[model samples]
Target: MVEDRRLAVLRAIVEDYVRTEEPVGSRAVVERHGLNVSPATVRNDMAALEEEGLIAQPHTSAGRVPTDKGYRMFVDRLTTLKPMSGAERRAISTFLDGAVDLDDVVQRSVRLLSQLTRQVAVVQYPTLTRSTVRHVELVTLTPTRLLVVLILSTGRVEQRVVELSRSELPDADALAGGGGPEVSAGDEPARVVDAVVADLRPRLLGAVVGKRIAEAGAALADLPAAVPDASRTLVRRVAEVLGEAMSDHHADERIAVGGAANLARYGDSFDSAVRPLLEALEEHVVLLKLLGEATAGGAVTVRIGTEGPYHQLASTSVVATGYGPAEAPATLGIVGPTRMDYPGTMVAVRSVARYVSRILDDA
Candidate 1:
């Protein structure tokens, strides 16, 4: 019972410190909270908490503040995350449901999180390796030039231009007997591009359905055989261009961040941790790794000050969670000072992540 009462004192201290951004004193705790205890008794509990390294007195006479260890204990011991209000849940769903596509969903989520938590928010794009092809469009620009467009289920599009080796059009006599345009060395490549586009349109690029961009590209390795002998060269070039476009998509994974201005709210209180955090936020790789560390198990993860591997972020805390399918989930989270509203922020992060996952699942 004594240890439990001490923990209650520690919790009171943390709550007051977060609210006022000032060290909490025994008098203030007794006055602001109904602990039903005397000032002297609270003081003794505070002393015990300090002895355990959970609270610290910044100066000789100032009240105590919860240390990083204290915050970790609070988070670990939290039995229930604070629930969002009815208005808050409605607003989140309304805002996210307005998103038209995957990129829009990511952008909207970053903005929503920042607004909800009043903290910097980071949201990663769906991985290309996990997205399937949505559409493939081939447009002829000239007799020897064609544009190949690859659209993915994640709403990412890639385009490339494939130039034929031949200067002269294919022979028209070869295609004379068919319902389509005649094909030969002297005939325009546009004829073949047009015919192939029509054929593939009905098929809906079945060659790439359900497979990742890279896998789809590989499956089309023998595309040349699917076309007439006269169009063999053009088919091969189209496949090659599609493969290159997939390579480009695989190299570009992106993330969105917003609400950096919120960090300035800490002012002098976070002087030690703000500068490096601002710099690290500018780097996508560092942000990705941070979020990656949290969502490794596809659950909500909280990293308090000094818990994050980097020394510079020791004064900041991260509340993050994974969104999307268990097979290929993405990360979303907020970054703030250690003396933050943990319960509220946890609710916001976890709630937003679930909404995002729902959006992706439906898409």
Candidate 2:
């Protein structure tokens, strides 16, 4: 019972400190929270908490504030995740509903997280290797040129241009039909390219549909052999280019960061933690590593102070979670000072992550 009371005292102190950004005294805890105990009892609990290194008096005679270890304890002991308000939920839905594509969804997610958490937000694009192919579109730009668009289940799109030649399209002249007056030089290219797309679309889709990018590329490797002699060379070029596009994963591994200005709210604390964090945000690899290091259980993960490797971020905290289909996970999270509202921030991160997952699932 005594230990429980000390924990309760620590919880009150952490909450009060986060809210007020000041040391929490025993009198203030009793006044603000009806602990059903005298100030003397609370002070004894505070002394015990300080002895345990959970709370500390910064000044010789000041009230106590939570340490990094204390924040970890608070996070671990949190039993219930605070739910976002109805208005907040409505805002998330409304704000995210208009995203037109994966890029827009990522951009909106970063902005929405930053706005909700009042902290810098970082979102990693969906990992393409885990994503299945959605569609393969072959657009006939010209008789010698085709545009290969590789669309993924994650809503990411990659495009590459394949070049064909008269030699590749031995049937080019045949497609022009004896150079009829109606089939001008310019018109002949269009006619042949259209024929190429019509022949390749279904075949290309068959090779890539429902497969991961790398797997789809492997499946497509043999597509040139399947093409009829009429367009073998042209089809071979298209297949080669499509394979290249599928293997391209640079965009999939990217990270988008927003709300660096929010770091300015740290005020004089900027030099201590906010500055390096801003630099790290610019280096997306750092942010990706930060989110990558987050717990992998799809639950909200909080890394407080030096719990993270970057000593420069010792005064900062990270709250993050994974989004997207369970098969293909992506990370999103908020960065803020250790003095943040942990319960509220965790709820916001979890809510946004869930909504992002829903959006991707719907996509």
Candidate 3:
């Protein structure tokens, strides 16, 4: 019972410190929180808490504030993560629902998180390796040139152009456009590209129906020889391009950041916190390190002050979560001072991440 009361006293002190941004006196803790105890009782509990190193007295005589350990205890001991209100949920859904594609989804997510949390928001793009093939589009630019577009379940699209050599084409001379034989329905270059795509598309889509990317790669491997001998070279080139798109680790893995200006609310005196986050935003590697552990599960991670990857931002905290299809997900979260509202920020970050994950799952 004594330890429980001390924890209550610590919780009250942390709450008041976050609100007033001042050292909380025992009288205020007693009167403001209605602890059903006297001022002397609260003072004794405060002394116990301070002795445990959970709360600190910055001055010789003043109310106590929570230390990094205290904040961690508060976060770890929280009984429940309160749900976002109906209005907040609807707003997040509506804002992200309007995104036209993958890039739009990420950008809108970053904006929504920043706006919702009023903190700097970071979101990583969905991984292609985990995404299923959505569609493959082939557009002919000319008799010798064709555009190959690869679409994925994550809403990411990759396009590449291929120029066929005369030696590889069965009817290269007749297939030429412009100064060559007039474009015809029977021999039009676009028709040739379409014929090849018709064969490639179904093989890719069928193999990846359940997110089997490797099977899709294997299905496409034989397409160069699978098609008619006339279009063999073109089919092989397009298949290679699509394979490259699937394995591309760089393009699909990128970070989107927003709301750096929110850091200013911490006050210039806390430049130590604000500046490091600002620099981390520019250096996505640091941001990735901070959010690296926030995998796709529905768990929210709270890294406070020195507990975070970089102790330099000792005055800052990170609340993050993973979003995307469960099989393959990316990270999203916020950065703010340790004094910021933890419960509210954690709720917002998680709420937005769920909505994003749902959107990608359905897409």
Instruction: Enumerate residue pairs that collide in model 2.
Output: none
Residue 315, candidate 2: alpha-carbon lDDT? 91
lDDT of candidate 1 over 216-292, digit per residue (tens):
87777866676565555666777887887777656434889999999888899888888999999989988887775
Best by lDDT: 2
**Reference-based TM-score of each model:** 0.86, 0.89, 0.85
Q: Which tens-of-lDDT digit does each residue in 207-302 have in candidate 2?
A: 889987778878887887775555667777888887777676746558888888888877884468877887787787778777754432378889
Q: How does model 2 fare in lDDT?
A: 0.81
Global CA lDDT computed for model 3 = 0.78
Which residue pairs in candidate 3 collide?
24-63
Local distance difference test, each candidate:
0.79, 0.81, 0.78
7: Cα error in model 2, Å: 2.1
TM-score of 1: 0.86
What's each prediction's clash count?
13, 0, 1
